[model samples]
Each structure stands twice: as C-alpha cells, then as structure tokens.
Target: MAELKNRQWLLAARPAGMIKESDYRWNETAVPPLKDGEVLLRNLAFSFDPTQRGWMSMDTYVPAIPLGAVMRAGAVSQVVESKKSGFAPGDLIQGMAGWEDYTVTDGRGMLGLQKLPPGTDPLLALSLLGITGLTAYFGVLDIGLPATGETFVVSGAAGATGSVAGMLAK
Candidate 1:
C-alpha cells in the first residue's frame, strides 16, 4: 500500500564478544514490491537473543554480517498487501521478516492471521507461543529425551525458551 521506505539495524564491524550497539548500524532503505507468489509484510516485531550474538562474532562461529548488510533478526509482521495464494492482506504472522518496515515475503513461511490464538496479548503469541513454543515443543524435551518427572534444567534460564522449558518441566 504505502511506499516501502524502511529503516533497520545492520551488523557493522564484527564484534569480538558480547555484541555492542556499535557493532550494528541503523539504516534506511527502500523495499521493493512483491512479485507473483510474493506478499509484502509490514514488520510488527522481532526477537533478539543469544544466537544473534554468536552471529556477530568471527566467521568461524557464523558468517559475519558484512559491514553494510542489514542485521539478521527473526521477526513477525502483518500483511499490508498480497498477490500470493494462501495469504490475504491484514494477516498477522511470525517468521523471519528481518528488521524493516516492509518485507517481500515469497509466500514463504507466512502464517495466516486467523490461525493465531484469539487474544490481544502480543507477547504471548509472538515470542512465547510462536517460535519459543515451537522450540519448547521440539527442542528441550525432544533433544534431552526427558522421562516423566525427570529433572530438566534450561540453560538460558532468563530467556523465552528457558522460561517455557522451566514451566513445562514441572
């Protein structure tokens, strides 16, 4: 609908350890229109956590985010407009829409707004119920192979996944 003039944070100089704000840069750029089978999403929210910190480190851990590249962050967005099948405008969803106002989603990983739980609490579904929930459903329990009533400990105890895992452990 509106022109895609968006701004975002990008990894600038690679960091040695615990990523600093200076390691990233704020940028303004124009997003292109979505082509056939593509939907343009207006980003609503994004997640910043430990892995992103790893990405900011040396290339051995993960590729560096070249100085001018837009920083990689997992995000959710609402469809402002769409030409793709299975997606309509105004749908709320979660996925990798990056950190920008408008993103051209190629019908890739777009979640229909109707499928989200009927509630207004963004944090519940966005961070907790969405990716974090999916991870909790599959990660800790799946990977750890906990038996019934096994004592499970979540490593990143302060984060979304750990919080959910801790609850599920009880």
Candidate 2:
C-alpha cells in the first residue's frame, strides 16, 4: 500500500479555449489499501478524445469534473489486486479511471468496468475498438444511415471518432 504511488493529473482550472499543461496539476499519493468489494487498478493507457472538452465545460452528459480533482478520462488497466468477487488479479478492465497511474473501484457507478477478453490488445481496446469506435459505429450506422456512394462529412476529421467514422464510412 505505502509502497505503491498513485500519480494523477488533477484539473487545475477550466480551459478558456484550448487546453494547456498549466490547466492541470500532477502529483503522486500512496495507493490506499483495498477494502472489501473493491479492486485496485494499475492504469496502462489513457484515451484522449473530443468529449474531454465538454467535460471541462459547465455540463454535459455527465457533471463537470470538479476543480482540484483528478481529470476524468477513460483508461485501460489491469486489476493488480482485488477484494471483489467479480474481479481477480491480472484481469484487464476498461473503465473511467481518470488521469491517474492507479484507481480503486467497487465495480459501481463506472462507465463499465468490463473485462477484456483474454489476450485482447490494450491499445486496440483503448482506441479504435473503444468508445470512439462505438461512437463512430453508432453515428454512421444509426444516425447517418448513408446509402452506398453517398458522401458524408466529418467535423473533427482528425479526431478519434471522426477518423474512425470516416474509415468505417468508406
């Protein structure tokens, strides 16, 4: 517990237009001991998407992440320790673990602390095959519904969702 360091990026202030490093504060704290029904996650990779801006604003699908708190972001992590029945050590999980080296959860009130299939690539799971991929999939198939040969335009063309949607559309 005391040996483990939980490095985190905390939101220092809201962005005026574009985000900068000064907008966040980085620090490390000891990883607390896991309680019953909780699991300790060692984050491997983080997902950066356009939705992060919305999260910085006053409101969106979810409440804005409070100042001085860990910046909110999805991550692909491994269960380093667990006291929960549904999880075990070495299990790969995807969830909203924020911008931190480690997180602790009870598998509750999270995006979905889903376990990745054995041997699943963490990079793939965190990017094109993750939320961005799902947003593109639904946007193009459900919302756009373009027929063959129809031209579709993407707004944030270079972003995760836009890039993925473009590829899927093509």
Candidate 3:
C-alpha cells in the first residue's frame, strides 16, 4: 500500500502538433492492493509511433485524453501483485500501461503469457516485426492487393512499414 504512493506521468494535456514531454504531467498515486481480478504491474518498456499522435487528435482516435491522467502509451510489464485467477507474480505482459513506475489494471486488453519469440527482440517488433510488420503486410498484399511483381508507389516510403512493403513488393 505504501508503494502505491509513488508517482507516475499522466496525460497533462493532449498534444497540439506533437507530444512534447511538456504535454504530460507527473501523477503521485497510491498503488492499492488488488481487489478481485486486479493486478499491480511494474512498468518496463513501451512502443511509440505516429498514430499515437493521431490518437491525440479528436478526429482520428477515441476521445482525447483529459488533462492530468496517465499519458497514452503502450507498455510491457511484470505482475508484482495479483488478485486474479490464472495470474501470478513475474508474469510478463503487454498493454497500454502508460508512463508510470507501477500500475494497477484489471487484467484486460493484455496479450502475452508466453515468452517473446527467440531473438525476436521486442524492440525489433516495435519496428520491423511488430505493428510495423502488420501494417506493411496488410497494406500491400492484403488491402491494396498487388499482383506478382507489380510496382507499388508508397507515401512515407522510408517509414517503418512502407520500406518493408516496398521491399516486399519487389
């Protein structure tokens, strides 16, 4: 319970053009003991991308963040405390945990009870093999439906997914 008193960064203001670190604020919150089906997790690492800025925009994603809450960021974390079934300490997970040293979540929207793939570095997944890979894989071959050896024109051509899509198209 004393640990919950530690601080975190909440979304101080929704970004206007970009998410300068100024658009966020530090939150000192209590790390309460878990009630049924809740878990306390220690923040590890997270992924950041351009679409996250879009999520800040009222036009693109869900409602904009109200000032003074944890800024929107995805995270990989470890369970330090749990009151849920089928989960325990030391379990690694991924989800939108925000910018905090610790977080308490009701085990939802999380994936990964299994270890990350061998040598498939999660950071690489953050780039080449993660969301970027999915974006590239679906964009060219799925939605756009390129024929064999057809030339593909791409915007953001040097970006994470576009580069992969261009290479894949060749």
Candidate 4:
C-alpha cells in the first residue's frame, strides 16, 4: 500500500488573552505503524468546544496542550488499521483525538474509543449523541433534578449543551 501522511496543527504558543491563528502551526508527518493494542484512525469530524480554550491555555481537567504537540480535540473517526481486539477497519468510533488527518490510540484516553452504532450520524455523534448530549442528560437529570411542574431554566440555552438540556427538560 501507499504511504499515508498525517497532517496536523500543532500548538505553536499559548494565548495571552485570546486565541489566534498564530497560536497553531501546520505540520505533516508519515503515519506511524500501529503497535500492539493500538488502532489507526482516519479523522472524519472534529468537535470544537469552549473547554478546548482552557485546555490550550492552562491545565484544567486535563493538562494544557504542550507547545509543538498536536492540538487536542474530540473527533469521530473511522478505523483504518487495528492491532487491537474488538475493533476492525471500517468501524466508526468516537473519542479524544487530535487535530490531525490520522490518529493512533490504545483505546484508553479520557473518553476512550467507543464504537458508534451502525448508521449513526457522525456530526451528531460529536455533539448531541456524544459528550454534549451526555453532559446535558446527566446535568439536568442528576444535578438539576427538576420535579414535575417545576420550571427548569438552562443558563446557556443557545449552546449545544444548553439546547439539549432545555429539550430534555421539556
């Protein structure tokens, strides 16, 4: 087979106040061969979230994206090669991936690799069917716990999470 190049956007520098195009640098490298227990993925879609800013600027739930490293983001991807059990080529999965054309994972990151159900919408898997939807579902049901007839108010009702939360509350 032909060689595959991995295109990436690396974190060039940390932002002082606001993030800019200068904060990232473009990169391309040969796709590495998969190791045992690792799976190769071709990124199909990425999820842009407000928390990624915090990830770029400082350590929050996760450490900051280091300078010269691939910028971190959530993505829906298709498995291209697998040395791992339970995953095979052509299977669609979602998890924490980087801003790159290809990714290699051992299925043990923060979100871990999850096989998307057949015919699942990739875009929705990144949003309403992924973390955003889960956050909204649990936040409202577990934390908020509004009873019948109680008015549920979502603060950021216009955002992905808020919009889903509002719908769940209805």
**Best-matching candidate per TM-score:** 4
lDDT of 1 by residue, 1-170 (tens): 56668887777787865657887788888878778988877787777756666656656444655677776656667778888887787777666656677777674433433324445555566667776777876776678667786677788768888888777766
Higher-TM-score candidate among 3 and 4? 4
Candidate 4: minimum summed lDDT over ten consecutive residues — where? Answer: 1-10
TM-score of 4: 0.96
lDDT of 2 at 69: 89
RMSD of candidate 2 to true structure, Å: 1.7
Show pairs that collide, candidate 2.
none
| Model 1 lDDT on a 0 to 1 scale | 0.69
The TM-score values for the models, in the order shown, are 0.79, 0.91, 0.79, 0.96
Q: Write the per-residue lDDT of candidate 4 for residues 15-64, one digit (tens) a residue.
A: 88889999999999999888999999999999999999999989998888
Tell me the TM-score of model 3: 0.79
Stretches of candidate 3 exceeding 4 Å from the true structure: 109-120
lDDT of all predictions, in order shown? 0.69, 0.87, 0.69, 0.93
* Angstrom error at residue 154, model 4: 1.3
Instruction: Assess candidate 2 and give its TM-score to the true structure.
Output: 0.91
RMSD per candidate (Å) reads 3.4, 1.7, 2.9, 1.0
Tally clashing residue pairs in candidate 1: 1
lDDT tens readout by residue for model 2, 72-112? 78889999999999898999998888788889888776486
Candidate 2: lDDT of 123?
A: 86
RMSD of 4: 1.0
